[model samples]
Target: MVHQIRPRNSASASMASRKISSMLPSLMRQVIVAFIVGVLAACASRAPAPAPGAPAAQEPAPVRLGPLGGPLAVPGTLSQYRSHWVPVAWEELPGWQDDALHEAWEAWLRNCERPAPAFAPLCPEARRLSIASEEEQRAWMQERLRPYRIESADGNANGLLTSYFEPELQAARVRGDGYEVPLYAPPPGLPARQPWYTREQIETRPEVQAQLAARVIAWVRDPIEALVLHIQGTGRLRVQEADGSTRLVRVAFAGTNNQPYQSVGKWLLERGLVRDATWPGISAWAQANPDRVQEMLWANPRYVFFREEPLDALAADAGPRGAQGVPLTPGRSIAVDRSSIPYGTPVWLASDGPSAHLARLVMAQDTGSAIVGAVRADYFAGSGEAAGELAGRLKQNLRLWALWPRQ
Candidate 1:
């Protein structure tokens, strides 16, 4: 949702300024332990095994003893999971200063403040954000911020800002939490473009101007929390259609070699798909192909790989042999942020698939080009002849959490 459309004359300078502004919060120190635990829980629950020629869905298999019990013992402590933090501008804080926006944010924060809550335990560290000295705050900001700059296809620059969030913050309000916070509906008669300023009306829109001012104030005064980052990857999926059709859909950046058959950009260019190509194309293609989707996945090399067992028993069985002749198992693998969650941490992932209830400790052995940012992960199904049939057919939303050292 980038709103700044104007181009900047200098790109590097904009990035440098943005980098300095997006600082990590001191509160991050308090949540490290909990954040690490969350990552491990997610890795422990990998995707369940797929039934022969079945469409992938979210389900866990009955727990079974594998040769390797859980995530392999590693040298580093969870403390090592701490890495650089980045600052993010609060450009789109939803209901900025509007009564609705204020209520939503405050309610969310209050729920976070509760003790032993379902969400990450809120600490005084976050509450104490206002006391820092300017120098201290600037120093902290410099240490953790990563500049997010926009560069157009023509190499022209766009507006820049210091915006980023800590990688570990997780906050959400769910049903039955018992707090009974009502949802905020949009204000009556709100314009279609409540905040976005058109070139012609930028000078005349008093509400828009006030909204922007309020956003800046919130950015300056609010205590920092987790950051949201984007992850991009290239892969192929085998989509199955209800009509018993199947298709191999390539997914990647538009110019990449493995672009999905119905990629959004391509579809837009071909006028077969609308503006948001990748997601829409994949969805549309799946609707068109159903029965042979699994088979099509088995045929593609881009979507299959091995998920390392949390503790590589075969590797450990080799007893210091170090990745030698370890028997690899055929299973799905996912890439996760090593910083928020360590690599090789065991996770429990629940998906809608045949592999439901299948439990296995996972090794964070690999990363994909698109698998970056906190709370982000990538899953890999096995490879070679054994995996050929079950690879790309996986298309399911997953709920992930980790299992690790008791807090």
Candidate 2:
């Protein structure tokens, strides 16, 4: 989670100082490849029949193909409190026609599953648009949904849009095979609001470990992997059971220790140990200062526990269910603060800044502690390592428009 909240006075300056994750593009591509292979393997047993006239050997492509090409832009209007929809024409939304609306249709339908009163009216229209032309769909949306730009009451139009993803990891049912670190369920009697054992105590304290003696959901080798799974709040675990067979399962967020969350990147930067506070930078620093690994992990006292969820072909095909009780659509789902934009709202998001540029339709199906304010959003990029790298690096000025049902 990003520690720095946007200060009111220097919104632009605050973003400028934020370090983009330094993971190499080639490495990110490789991570995506690994993730694709894993997905295919999980789906191999339940292969779907090819559609008529489709390539016989072709498999379904993963959601969200790659990194942002460059800057995405179009004419947009900004104003204080609220921006008038009257002056904003459909033509103002950049790349509206280019985006594969069908790809986001699943997310829209997911919204309808727990439909907000306002979106309920548009449900029938959204379903039939799968076969419609992009232009036709655009016109349909214009009639069905109204878009209004948002700014903070203090008049800040520029907000932050970062991203998040589910990580995939190899794990074990038993403590053998170098998989020593155990992810636990909340130990019995840990108070909901009280801070439990810190990360350090979880590591070193015998008494604390006793409470979790048999509470190993799965065992992962790297402490870093454990920390990452904890941070992402959900992940796919390729667990090998003692029977010498393996099946994949999701380790989902259960509860937190109520301790303060701190960014490991910030820890390195504060000590003048690194210039760029990204994953690669952190890994490089760890390599150099191997002894300080414990110290770094201790910086954040918060500990997250997990519960094992059985994964099937369908569950494996899609992402973990978000707080909205629906599977998240990789590119189109965003986590937002409920107070500003209610869950199930469709939002038009665009950004053009020194670091990144994007424009797309997203569903506000999830929320995070760090995701606050009228205009802020956390874009769900995709799953696995590449997605996480992009999520960490994504700190850019954002423009937003909430697409509410037309009156």
Number of the top-ranking candidate, with TM-score as the measure: 2
Runs off by more than 4 Å, candidate 1 = 1-76, 80-329, 353-358, 384-389, 405-407
Candidate 1 lands at a TM-score of 0.25
lDDT by residue (tens digit), candidate 1, 1-407: 00000000000000001221232333332231111111111122232243478665333322222122211232234333422212123121111112212212222233233322212332243234335554443343223322211112232221111101112112122222221111111223334423322211322357744543322100111111101111111112232323546443322211111211121123233644333333334334434553422322222111111111222333221111001111212232344545544443333334434322322323333343334444343443332222222221332334344433222
Give lDDT: candidate 2, residue 316.
73
Off by over 4 Å in 2: 1-87, 279-281, 353-356
Question: Considering only N, C-alpha and C atoms within 3 Å, which residue pairs clash in candidate 2?
Answer: none
| TM-score of each candidate structure, all chains considered together | 0.25, 0.77
Please give, for residues 263-378, the per-residue lDDT of candidate 2 as tens digits: 66567779998776544465567667766666776776777777888889876767777767778888899887666666788887777644355677889888777678776887
RMSD of 1: 27.4
Worst 10 residues of 1 by lDDT: 4-13
